[model samples]
Target: MDKFDKKILTALHENARISYAELARRVNLSAPAVADRVEKLEHAGVITGYHARINPAKIGYPIQGLIELTVKHQDYYIVMEQLGTMPEILECFSVTGTSGLLLKVAVHSMPDLQALIARLMQYGDTKTSIVIDVPVPLRMPEVVETE
Candidate 1:
């Protein structure tokens, strides 16, 4: 990607909903040019997709947590598929180390979290931590284009 493309990505990373005109202004390009570049970025898979960042608590989900799971090697794919069907498990990653998976979960109450944990426990050993507050929640990455 060129400098202009890097600028376009940085702008989108900061504000995914930014208007073409505004984006062009920030990158010193015409609106149509900005639109074309964004389309190319999407086609090239640099820009995956856009999403709304919603506060879980504001939507009645007051509990947020992280879970570490250790599952049977043979049951790995089965457990991953099961996790995909659970809405409470917002995100899951198969990471390196002793643990098989790391998960980000949300729920309306402690009781809900408990029930969810009970079901998850059937698949493997689990370690969970409830988040009481987030000082700096999620953030965008800084992209530095290489020569």
Candidate 2:
């Protein structure tokens, strides 16, 4: 990838829905050139997927939390697969240390959280911490040095 490719990626990070013509204009490239670059990026897996940000409060799930789980043995993949199917579990990770998995969850209320935790009991021991505020939510990927 060259400087032009980097510029194109930066622009796409800001707005993935930008038209090919508009992207070409901003990047100072012809539409076909821009299209070719973007296609290459997509094929190479540099551009994985596109998504829209949604407000949890607007969706009736106002509460957000992180859950730390300690499972018996090393059955993280099985437990993670189950968590993935649950609507309340927004994100899940297989982590290092005593806590085998960490999960980001969103729910309607404390009662909902409690119910979710109860269900998770079948899998393993769990602890939860409610999020007070997200000072910095997830951001778009920025340019990074590659060896």
Candidate 3:
């Protein structure tokens, strides 16, 4: 990747919907050149996918929380499969330390969260924490020139 590629990536990270002409202007490249570079980036898997950020509270899921679960060694994959079927689970990660998995969940109410936890406990012990605020929301990695 060259400087122009990095600039194109940085611009796209700021706004994925930017037109090729605008991107070309920002990167000092022709529209066709910018499009070709973006295509190459996509093919190389440097650009995975684009997404829209949503507010759970506005969408009727006001309660948000983190769940730390420590599952038995034999039930790890089974628990992961079950978690995939649960819509309330927004994200799940296989983590280290005492916890085997960490899950980000959103629900309509405390009762909903309670029910989800009760279901998860069937796998193993769980620690749940309600999220009051998110000071720094998810941000894409900023592309920078390498030495």
Candidate 4:
């Protein structure tokens, strides 16, 4: 990717719903050129997908929790696949520590959290911690300099 392509990606990452003309303006390119570059990016798998960021509290899911799980074996892919299918599981990661999987879950209430934990325990050993306050839940990616 060139400098223009990098600028386009940076703008798109901030707001995926931006119009091609607006994106072109930001990147100092013509709309057609921006469209072509975006299409190429998508086709090449550089732009995998676009998603809407949602507020957990606004949708009645006020509770957020992190779960650390230790499985019987190193079958992370299978476990991650299963966890991904669950709606409550917001994110899952494999870390080099005591736990095999770290999961971020959002729930409506304590009962919902209990149910989620119960269901997860069926697959492996689990430990959980409810988030009281979030100073920084998520952050936007900074502009990365490309060679």
Candidate 5:
């Protein structure tokens, strides 16, 4: 990507809903030119999707935690499919470690967390760590021009 493309990405990363005119002003391009670049970025897969960041606590879920699962090799896919059906799971990742999967989850209460754990235990051994405070939440990398 060029310097202008990088600037557009950086601007969008800061605020996805920015108007084409505003983006054009920030990038020193015409509105049509900015729109074209953004469309190209989207088509090229460099720009994925836009979303709103919401607080779980504000929406009834007050507790958040990470759950690590040690699943059998044969049961991995099964567990992955099942995870998709569970709305409490915010995110899941397959990482290189003793644990096969790591999950970020949110719940309404301690009892709900316990119940979720009970359900997950059927798939494999689980280790859960509740979040007390978020020193650093989710953030995206700033787009910078590469040499």
Candidate 6:
């Protein structure tokens, strides 16, 4: 939106729990104005949801990976359904190229990972890659002002 809105968003992205007064100060607006902007932003779907970043390893999910699936046919909805029911699948994406679906998975042990892969293989061929380390952890994208 405007520069003030962008500033508010940048401040909130850094800390969602920031007080309205503090946000107002950062954006050079009154607290009420800042609150109104935040409300509008939420209503407009610019701010969808807030979340806490957790350590998967510390939470007993030592294994994290991406599974690239190349399905047998076009009707892959069944596979998508099954993937939705699986707690191990954190995120799924439909990308172009060879892979029909890409899944982000988290599991506790090697046995669990093997079982997940076996279940997935029933749909079609899959390529699994365990995450060794993340150089850039997930972060909020910048809210640049646009025309």
Which model scores highest in TM-score?
A: 5
lDDT of each: 0.92, 0.88, 0.93, 0.87, 0.94, 0.90
Tens-place lDDT digits, model 4, residues 2-88: 888889888888899999999999999999999999999899998899888898989989999999988767666677778878999
Q: Candidate 5: what lDDT?
A: 0.94
Ranking by lDDT: 5, 3, 1, 6, 2, 4
Tens digit per residue, CA lDDT, model 2, 1-147: 777788889888888899999999999999999999999989999889877878897999999999998887767678777887999999888789998889899999999999999989889989999998989976666666342
- Over 74-123, each residue of candidate 6 has an lDDT whose tens digit, in order, gives 65988888889999999999989898899999999999999999999988
Task: Give the TM-score of each candidate.
Answer: 0.94, 0.89, 0.91, 0.84, 0.94, 0.92
Residue by residue across 101-126, what tens digits does model 1's lDDT show? 99999999899999999999999999
Local distance difference test, candidate 6: 0.90
Indicate the TM-score of model 6.
Answer: 0.92
| Runs with alpha carbons beyond 4 Å of true place in candidate 5 | 144-147
The C-alpha RMSD of each candidate to the native structure, in angstroms, is 1.3, 1.9, 1.6, 2.2, 1.3, 1.4
Per-residue lDDT tens digits for candidate 3, residues 1-147, read 889989988888888999999999999999999999999999999999876778999999999999999999999999899999999999999998999899999999999999999999999999999999999877667666664
Ranking of predictions according to TM-score = 5, 1, 6, 3, 2, 4
Which residue pairs collide, candidate 4?
none
Better of 2 and 4 by TM-score: 2
In candidate 5, which residue pairs clash? none
Task: Pick out the ten consecutive residues of candidate 3 with the lowest summed lDDT.
Answer: 138-147
Lowest lDDT sum, 10 consecutive residues, model 5, at: 138-147
